[model samples]
Target: MKDQSNSNNDPIYYQEATTLAKLIRNKEISSVEVVQAHLDRIAEINPRINGVVTLMGEQALKSAALADKAVSSGEELGPLHGVPFSIKDAIDTAGVPTKRGSKIFEDFIPEKDATVVTRMKNAGAIPLMKTNIPEFSAHWESDNLVTGRSLNPWNPDRTPGGSSGGESAVIAAGLSPIGLGSDVAISLRGPAAFTGISALKATHGRVPYTGHFPQALSRFWHIGPMARTVRDVALGYSIINGADGIDGYGIFAKDAAPATFRIPGQKIRVGWVSDTAFGPVDPEITTAIKATAKLLADVGCDVAEVRLPFMENTDWLTPYFNLVYGELVPYMQQYTRGRESELHFIGKATMDYPLLNAAEYVKAEATIEKLRMHFAGYFQEYDVLLCPVNPMTATGHGLNEYIVDGKTVSAYHVMTATAPFNMTGLPALSVPVRLSSETLPINIQLVSRWFDEATILALGEKIQTGSEAYGKHPIN
Candidate 1:
């Protein structure tokens, strides 16, 4: 890991996507310039971080040139006009290799873009590159047979949180201004927390999951925006959200147009939790959660420490893992049956996941409904539930277990704070609040009721305002 504090000297690379759009629209900077700068930054920084796996420099530059031409013609521009953004390899990109972090589909390239990618392109954001991920996106660390592992930008020895780790690492290092990432359990929030960036996993169906790899786990899957700033995340989410008429889950997505900016008229009610359900939270992380509650209260919001009994008593993880592995294990077996030796550590471990019987699976589904009702009941009283994104800060790469708060905990325990939201299909946003004693970032997960992204995003913006993590890049 090179300690190039001046690696992020170029202001263009660090500017938010929202700012880049304005700069390009106002002719202060050309789209080509911005695109080229990001591509150059990727060239310089990607080798050390291994975040971006495939580059589209030539295609991106051509697209940028066309964008510049469109500007010259004074044509109508979209909200993200002339901005460059990245896509996770698990998502399809037309004519670009989306390897999905697996050797099986290493050469696979989709002829059509995913719904989210199409929406972003239509909004005038150019696809820059594909980021790394855990093989089949089934692991906690972003290592795979196809692209190896994505290292944390904060410290190369540590692992960036999995699946969307590459997206978080690049955004945190200023290689890309904004990007798209998918979340199953903690893919979006955990990585964003690990890298000191902001990510939004909107209500499950708020964004379509069409064309994403391993389509088996679509029930718990969500695709959303990841960026360094809340405003940029809001901008990206606004463009990519809503039913696309393709995904089954998308068809039932509630209309967010009316409530896009609807902040609660009353004093915002915030409930903070630290150690009730989420096991073995770091002491520094608990302090940060309390500090965040104070921050909310100081801002005149009705903030209090509260616990959800359902969370404490019920086993959310069993049902979540049952559903996840129920679909994913079989899907993975088809590809790894004959060539298991080619599998990466995470990929091989995924194969060992136990599959539930029909009765057990049906029971798991019922439990999910029960959990949803529990959250719905709680939300009727409180507008937001704030908690730690992960029990510990970013950990060193390739560890199967972690010692958090002096207790040895399984690697899957980190997902304790994040998986419940995925099961309930609620809107959750990860915002960096403070740094740990080791200078690692500590993020607070703000979850809102179904289709109530506005509440969490509004709260995220307020939390972001006081965050030292904002505008501070790890590479710098």
Candidate 2:
């Protein structure tokens, strides 16, 4: 750990938070310098990234003062002692504006921190600011009227990926060391892939979703950590985990698998995805997949091209969309019925959901059940399923539709990999592995059984071990 004589010397912000915590614990630095350095970093980089919209400079400084006092007086320090952290705008922070990336409620401030936020604070993580998100937390794009769009630090014209896009933006840009992001589907992973950062969407119910947006209000969403490294992801999860006691869909936390965290005798069997699964991905993305497969195989993993129905049931896409649109109908209607001046045009798309007839709902339910059964059959053979979190790096910003190499498609098309897992309630992760041809970060990863996040993350940790530049610097 660096001493206070040069506590804030690290040019890389990703290392700042953990280093700050270590310094404070070892009396090499005070909490105040750590907090101020982060605040200063936010002021420096956030303008370009827009990752942090609402700054808590004053509150963060105050918290740092208290934490240092405690440290000096020999009081106990939590796991995240005096480390500064940012919350995705979708998550509540007491008295802080969490606009959920829409103009309709841009000024909405909550009276209490979301349960996840509260738990993180209880661990002594300093509240630096709230990051950005997409409107109503819909779509994978993180931009909304509230804070505009969070641009990719790698290339400003490209998007950072959505929903949790802002969180990825900040971490990738080195604006904040770590932040919270809720993933309904590929929200976290999309940006993680595009930004080349570490993130994990824990099994639903393992992480509480209380006090967040409509996505968190429902059962099909999860809140997880976005960080520059796997250890950081594990640290963030270790803090905010367990039941928050408010979300009705949130069950009590489960016991940890084992202290050793090593599958002593079992060979890692990962079903790899080659060129054709869940729609065509960019060749760059596929190249990363093949490279990863080779690495795993070289490392003694039983890696082979095993196709497990990722795109076997394209006929069911409409039904899945119906289920999604149905679940989001109320929120869509609320914004749609809202005054045009009060809402963004995207929210208007959601407004028409109420008009769907009874037949549509019935068909959607049947399709979902069948899809779930089909996916369950795939898991019977493979312990883990490797795939893309997104097909390419972050796409162009502000374009409702995407045109990939002369092929036009809906903006939502990129999210195919993630949504299917959510549809089946399977646990998935998007681990940052390598950068794309454009030098944008690519997240290469896999999914496991419903409650088997440990296996997915275990493999992610292994893959991350081979990536030297994955978290080199969000800032040039």
Candidate 3:
């Protein structure tokens, strides 16, 4: 990460979305300037990274100009007014081609914005572009037949973890201040960690899922915001979270404002674990998690090293994969029936996933319930759970397996630290804490109870304040 604060040397594209909005509102800068700066950054850096698959420069500039006019007229402004944000291709955008990184839907343009997209625009945030993703967002790396692979901004030789890889790369490279992305397993948090940014996967149903592609596996799917700082992520999450009436799962979602730290004299109880039943973790990652726990404890929070019994004994991955692919494979087959030859390697692999039988499906459902109960019981004692975002740092391009702590493991092992929360539908935040020996980012995940995003977010802000990785962008 390098400093880009010299206005004459570099554009303000690296500033946080919250700061940009304030500058636009106070008349220190025009919305057009902020939007154009980001568009220019995308043009300059995207050629190497291939992160932005669809650029909305023309429309974004037009919208920015209109936003400036509204500001000049003394109109009331939203929190993110005129700030440019990127959207994952998996999420729909009106008048934009949301191909979901597949050739089958390559010509499809959404007629309406997804509920989360609409909420962002309603709050005056301009859509800058549609970032890349795996076909139907089924893989960890963000490569597809439609947009190819999204390389890491820190090192082009490595991957920006997917399926939100494109969004992560663009933001980490200072192409956009903030963005919207979805997660079923590691889509949001993994990419955020790989790219050295902040992302929050709010509790399931906290944000409506209407207008996203694939339209299956709604249970594990979550949509949230990604940015360079925790504050900007909080701002984006606040605006986009809430039910839209169209998503059945979101109907009963509770509305809670973002919480402030200190909690009125109560010490936040934090439980942390570097090693768990998930799988083998890299020693560097383990050290980072332990350091973060120490940081929280030093700051007056009641922190301790802890582990859950269910996580140690239960095989969550088998049930997660069986349940997800059981529904996802069939839903995706409809589009690839005759167009199978057009799919990328990841897409082809997704279609090859085994379908679950009746008994297995029932057992998977039972396991999911048990996981939820386990987390519920754990949360009764701790307010936040801190852990590693991934077992290793960003991997080389096209890697299907990785060596973690000298042990070879499948690439899906990256999801071990993340997908459990997706299954439990708990709110989770990924905050970049340090850079590895190779200068790659290492992040820690902060998870809170269901519908209790405020706790994790408030705690994330504390961790981010001392984070060396926050507010820093890749030079390339």
Candidate 4:
């Protein structure tokens, strides 16, 4: 509806959230100008990617006006003051229809904000719209009966990675600077890698998970920040990290202010792996990860190869699916009580699956603790673990198979490198390094000890300093 182009043709639409906030705070640009520029970009490009299914232009402009007034009133603003952000459809936004890319909840609107959303608003970030996701967010691609599908901005024929795919798509397409997304089994990390963006799957309970729907698998599910830069993730994490008194899983740090937000000065220990128990990683992806590790090592980091026995010879699906059906099936039944036919395909499949017994669930929980302890010992020798976020890059839409180094693997195999951290409830970050041979985005995963998101962020920042992945947009 408006022309948002700059005179020199530099794409202001793709500027990072922190840059936009600084401009607004310094009066170099108005909040309305920044929000309107992004709204214009979304209107222009979202049709191709289908990243943003809902439009909140009017509401965003109103909020931007209020932010400008606050700046004019000489009030001290939060870190993200006057920045525009999007919310994954799975996360609740007060008065917004959080349809979750499904038909059953197509008409549903939340009366209150999610804890993460509340904190973002408190930090002066305005919600521009709701991004798309899979039906009930159960798949690796963001498509459903409601918003249809979200395509990768890098290549429309491919997916942007699922659940949080739409958020990553919009950010890569310059429609939004940053966004909020949830990860249960590689949802955020996978999409972030696929779309060439930076995302953090914060340690469990680091960010409160209150006010989200389908509270099944709450133990491992996490809501976190997806941005163009790793520093933005650290800033958003600080604002949203804390107990809200509603989420039973939320925790308070022992320190007055967590040091994870601060940059460390000493040389850090790092470990890397191209593949886990999952064999046959793409050669190009391995090269990208090795390049990233070498960059960190060049900057005075003690980088080496590290292996954990807990990650070998084991199928991640066994425990992950067991926990999913054991915990999520009941919640699915509660929602689809009498309307089985109304359920999405994945939801119906989940409901039809044979749930694990109480003993099996107990065993599954015990196995999770075992893997956690093994990784804990592994981290004792290294401050962070670097690995491939996915065995390959983004894949074609509506497809279920992938060719990873001449081996045909199912879609679930893409989660092999990521779901382990989800099972352990450890902090993991996905940082883009370079483009694959196919010209698709390739990213490296960074894992830290439980509740130690700071180390990963610090290390990601170091690599980012010498990398070309940051702010490289798909649509100029």
Name the regions of candidate 3 deviating beyond 4 angstroms.
1-10, 253-265
lDDT tens digits, residue span 212-258, model 3: 87789897899999998888899998888887889888764447543
- Candidate 4 collision pairs: none
Candidates in order have lDDT scores of: 0.87, 0.75, 0.87, 0.83
RMSD (Cα, Å) for all candidates, in order, is 2.7, 3.8, 2.4, 3.3
Candidate 1 colliding pairs: none
Candidate 2 minimal-lDDT segment of 10 residues? 1-10
lDDT of 2 by residue, 250-270 (tens): 675755442222256867677
| Model 4 lDDT tens row, 202-296 | 88887889977668888889999998778777787888888888889887652323223224675678888876655569998888888888898
TM-score of each: 0.95, 0.91, 0.96, 0.94
On a 0 to 1 TM-score scale, where does candidate 4 land against the true structure?
0.94
Off by over 4 Å in 1: 1-10, 252-254, 257-265
Instruction: Give the winner by TM-score.
Output: 3
**Candidate 1 lDDT trough over 10 residues, lowest sum:** 1-10
Candidate 1 per-residue lDDT, tens place, 311-418, comes to 785568888898888888998777889988877877877888888999999999999899889987888888889999999999998887999989998888889989
